[model samples]
Target: MKEKRYIMMVGAVDDQLSQVRASLTETMNQKNVITQWILSRDGIDAIGKVDNQKFDAMIIDAEAPRVLNADFLNGIGRHRNTNDCNIFVMSTQDQEQLHPNLQKYAFLQKPLQTEILLQGLSEALSQNLKPSMVEKFSVDVRVINALIKATMMVCQNYGLDQVDMEKPTPKLLELPWQGQSGAYLDIRSQVFSGGLILSFEKNVFLKIVSEMLGEPFTEIKPEISDAIGEISNIILGNAKSEFTSYGVEMTLPKILSLGQTIDQPAGSVSMLITFGTPMGKFFLEIIAHPRK
Candidate 1:
């Protein structure tokens, strides 16, 4: 059941809340949500609002006074409807300053873009969301998480400067991407079949490949496509043993050109796994069918 979401914005500092409002309003209509906003000039005031009412989501700015402590977080979530209430922490500082527990929640770079803000919100929503997906996908959440672990492993091997990922989200509509250069590998086992796709924006791809291959690439070249395939191979290869335990195996990667659309097989579900890097964001899409 889709319910009204009370979203509290703390330390807005300016007219930014309007930007968030506009963005959420645009997307909320598609998801059938009614978002109510609450404002606080500081964390102390925000604490009052949080304690008195139930909030599904709370966005806190780094500049919010007296909010960096664990006590604030400990207080804010108890009154939330779900134990997994969406909490976004925004900071201008490059290094993290929030409590260790708070660090796991969404952390946004300040001077934030409303578009990226919406993306962070969507990603956090996807993480905390749990309804009908397990039954519909017929796959355990552990399998999905293991895929994330495998992807992170590959990302680390490639020597990505920063490797932070949004938790996986299930996609119900057409998969939209800003960049078209990507690759996919077919995965199969006694219980699972489908494919895994690694995709990135053009600049992100160029930067990652350049760093991986020790060359400077300003634009797309045929070699870059091959590099994508090779990188994807390493990823699944690393996961092979782990997936073998789950009875999952993968085929060699197939490259996707600009604007190419992957054909989702019949009776399959796809999970969009987004990873944040110093360069930009890339995704690992698992389109899998868990057979009976």
Candidate 2:
């Protein structure tokens, strides 16, 4: 028998719903997943109808002021049909304050990137068929930027001197050890183990250390390596709170390592962000996978 298709609807304002519908339609076409969709202005009415119908997934555009309210989200969470269906929220506002009861739902941000949204949808839909331990998710650009900024602030607080800070560019480099290196952070979640691996150039590492230690250029040391690992741990801590609010659990502490090269795993996505500081050029490579 052919696989059962899914349904995705927009429960938000007219303009916001229109945008989501267009983006979702294009994404579904590419995946070739048959899906039914609709836009509903009233949350109560929408949930009432959805409760009686069947769908594989639902995309809720929380950007709409009327529908973004707590009561509305709560209503959707209470719906019976929603239990087995994948729920995705699209919003421009900070999702940290979303109703606690709605925390388990997935979310996408406004001005959505096609690839990112598609990847999120694919992962959510494939969740059931795949082994629970094999399921995974990625960090949104907004969250990633927040984590990077927090790391920089932590470095400053520790008296590290700042260097050249510039936007990250997407490019591949031939590393002496790892061969071709892609310019992006590939984040993932592991069922058994949880931690993050950050990849960056030696120069970037030196600059970050100098700023954090409030010292001038010097040779890398065990102390500096320890400090870098602690810094990564802090970033992960801050990022985890945001993830937890969305019903994603993260383990305590982050591990850091310094090496000439890193090996990229198969079936992973990459996000590239560049930073230029007065101290020097630094690139942050985030490779997150299951600990086990």
Candidate 3:
């Protein structure tokens, strides 16, 4: 019999982690892959376990303080068994000035989709064991296609005008890109950091607000931001469930953002997908890297 693939999860309480676990588990079972999973509430517990056990892979939350810094990653990377194990870091913080070695690991941004996670896992599983030469996972393009279709359906069902979607454009913008209402999107590129940063023009946001609230937008209301966040949350929740074949599990949290510049870690990538709605143009960016 083949040895089961074991996955360890480290993170604070968040919806994204929960969704990740659930989705992955379903996928694993479907594929008839034997697997085990462990969850840690803090970084210390996570590191301790990794040091002691030989896990096939790790799904860690990048925002969790204990695991967020370079010291922790370095410590784990030094572990003898870790050389053959996979690491998946999830984060919403911006990555800047990350150590070069850490960039070789896998990363997932918040509001993770199921297909993206599976792609990461598949890549990690396919790699030849080596020291720090982790495989990178690309978001399954089919998932993105479905998401675009879903967004259009939701808009039309909700009585909003249909939008035209274009192929995504790849570009790297400055971190903490300013958006409307004093909000900013921060970008990061390295491990254990936020996946991508998206800044929306104030006017464009207001249009979404008006449609969601069924009222004309005169000013930036706090409720408007909350609504946008909710929309994002719903979209991600649905997307994360699309990977039922890999036994990967996850819990996505409600979207929340302070009206400040969002900070993300370094070594990240972003793909801009624009949609032309009857009201105006809207955009959604996919930011992440494959697991090594």
Candidate 4:
């Protein structure tokens, strides 16, 4: 069920990204993943694409429309950070030419070898570790990273400056969560299918919604009741780019009103992740019904 992934190539030669695409296509089938390739004319065009769309990953040429600089590379890296998209740089020059400020990406030498490129891509995923407990708990780290990054970005974008993630705990369908209002998106893919919920306390939810809508609210008004659902949609949408590798699909999120509660989602497995917010804490619960 893997979805086609989009890749952006900045300042690349015509054949550069295509060959990488071919190599990826050949290798991914063995792993049940598929990717779609997009070539950027140069740095300028690449910037536009990078800003407007969600690319699973990016490859940049040292030429960078001739050559790259610290400022430009850092700029792109900052933008890509929200979604944790990997960046690979292609260069025929010395490593010194790369920006020291940018360390989160991979540097590939020219005379590109498909094996090296693939290896770099693989290692990039492993480069950063997830929250210690979640890392050890989840069987798949990629999905965990994708979802966590999306959660942090969404909250931060909504004005939560320092969101802290907590370890995931096993969830029981029969148990209730501690949040006042919440929403969850039901996800389905080759690996698992279940509801992914983000629950928040009454104050945190209201404050977040207030920041979101530029209005203050002490209760869930008709105008603000859908805020949780919208937040859930954004989280899944951002993660969907990475989920493409899993061929994942999701349904519109359902809201958990302040008074309403559920024991668990319709899946057999559930893992709960917590994020600390200014007003209080919000929870991210991943409930999965693993498919054989």
Candidate 5:
């Protein structure tokens, strides 16, 4: 199944974003893929959203607030959450006004042209459609990007610094019933159905629950478990909206107790993505099966 594409407009005029949205809607639907667009007036929030959610294309304005510095523009290129983003800068002024860090990227002259915007988006979406091999699952890069973005965003939101993403590894064996705590959210579509799991080591889980509640205690209280579940919910919840736009619906997240494991369906490919944070290291896994 063709995954949906999401487009974001940062610091763009309302009319410009609207026109781009219309163009993307028409083009993507004709390809039998759902498309959605989101707009942000502030560049910082826009960056955060882009970091937390995967977008096939991002149209950013040169004059957007809080984006005047070269360092900030550079950060966008370096951030793992956005490094894969197909960025297109939009400017009302001439090229001289663009930050030095943004000079290498493609640009869109404002007042935006529908044809140009559609063309750029079409190209960006095409780039994302190329399939990648991750063990047995022919996973889409957008799926991996979305999961990574959500993990990084949660770490940032919790004041965790220097978050690191480890390389994803394929899981061919059954998940062990080790003493681990986690949460899972099940997602379903006519084309695919599976679940996303966020599991943590004992110490890491405690730290996350403690910091989230702004207290310093270490025990898996019922509330602590609930807190962990909420964190998983937030991560999946953020991704859920993105998937929904693409025609997939996700159900309420469920918590897993110590030593519990969710089994993947037959023929599904499972992969683990580990994240290192100030608190500790945890992993998020996607075990999915494609429905022909």
Candidate 6:
């Protein structure tokens, strides 16, 4: 997969926030970069999201109700994973009056214009950007394509407006998959076999379930588990013909709880792929092994 860029937009709920988001989305979509926009409604939430997840760039409103602290800015620059992450400040104040550290970043005037916002973002991304190059698993491209298509179709069926899929990153068989929000299924075939895991963050899982069921759900109940399994089944069912071309078949899906781990076989190869949505992010793990 091509390198994906994650951006954080920080400001209060207002027209300006909506405008900035639209501008950012257009700029990123044009580049075909699978970008994730983590909307932070206030400085405090922005700080928390930046600390927890990695971001490629951050656009902050200086006049926000909860003013961003200098320490927060410093922290973003200091974090090991995000040291290269670019910061762009939006304000009407003079840049000269701001802290010397903050002055180093790009600045945009208020009432954000699409042309200017795009220019600033393009420049920020061009600096010291490194492409992600990971080894590929031995799975056939057809299988990968089918799964990717299934994922997108499922989300669209549930009313999601945008779905961004990143390139698949290879992984060793032994390393346990991260996160507990997922459903598991077994892949069977006369020639090869493995397990498939569809994982999501807590909020994303709930949102998907709500959409699939046509109702709102705040908790992960037993029925929610069944819904996720059914969705997984649908994806597999959608991709059944593609896998059949390779002489493979998928079994019924089972709910994987938050703490359970997969026991992979020796010498097996796998790839981890992630997708971003307005609600949150989700990932897929495909582990494949040749049957002896």
Off by over 4 Å in 2: 1-4, 11-32, 68-71, 101-104, 109-113, 128-196, 199-211, 214-226, 240-259, 264-292
What is the C-alpha RMSD, rounded to one decimal, of candidate 3?
15.5
Per-residue CA lDDT of model 4 for 14-125, tens digit only, reads 5755665676676554444556666776665766666767766777776666235444655676775325777776677644566664333555545654444654453333
Q: Model 6, residue 174: displacement in angstroms?
A: 4.1
Ten-residue region with minimum lDDT total, candidate 2: 176-185
Off by over 4 Å in 3: 1-3, 68-71, 97-102, 125-292
lDDT of each: 0.65, 0.50, 0.54, 0.64, 0.66, 0.67
For residues 222-290, could you state the per-residue lDDT of candidate 1 as single tens digits? 757778887776666765655666677667788876666667756777777688888778887767664
TM-score of each: 0.53, 0.59, 0.43, 0.51, 0.51, 0.49
| Cα lDDT of model 3 by residue, 1-292, tens digit | 3235677777664575566567666655544455577777766787777766787777776666666565566776777756678776655542223344544455454555445566556444434434243334335433344355555555555545665665557656343333553222222222212343333455666765677778988677765665655555444455454423322233333343544333334555656666666655656665655344
Candidate 4: the clashing residue pairs are: 1-247, 63-66, 63-67, 173-263
Give stretches of model 1 more than 4 Å off.
1-3, 13-16, 29-32, 79-82, 94-97, 119-181, 185-225, 232-253, 257-260, 265-292
The candidate, 5 or 6, that scores higher on TM-score is 5
Off by over 4 Å in 6: 1-138, 172-174, 189-192
Q: Sorted by lDDT, highest first, which candidate order results?
A: 6, 5, 1, 4, 3, 2
Candidate 6: Cα lDDT at 180: 46
Q: What tens-digit string does per-residue lDDT give for candidate 6 at 91-142?
A: 7775556666665565554544344455446545534444322211133333
lDDT of 2 by residue, 68-107 (tens): 5555676666666666776776666545666555545665
TM-score of 3: 0.43
Question: Is candidate 1 or 6 superior in TM-score?
Answer: 1
RMSD of each: 8.3, 6.6, 15.5, 13.9, 13.9, 17.7
TM-score of 1: 0.53
Most TM-score-accurate candidate: 2
Q: What number of clashing residue pairs does each candidate have, in the order they appear?
A: 0, 20, 54, 4, 0, 2
Native-to-model Cα distance after best TM-score fit, residue 176 in candidate 4, in Å: 1.8
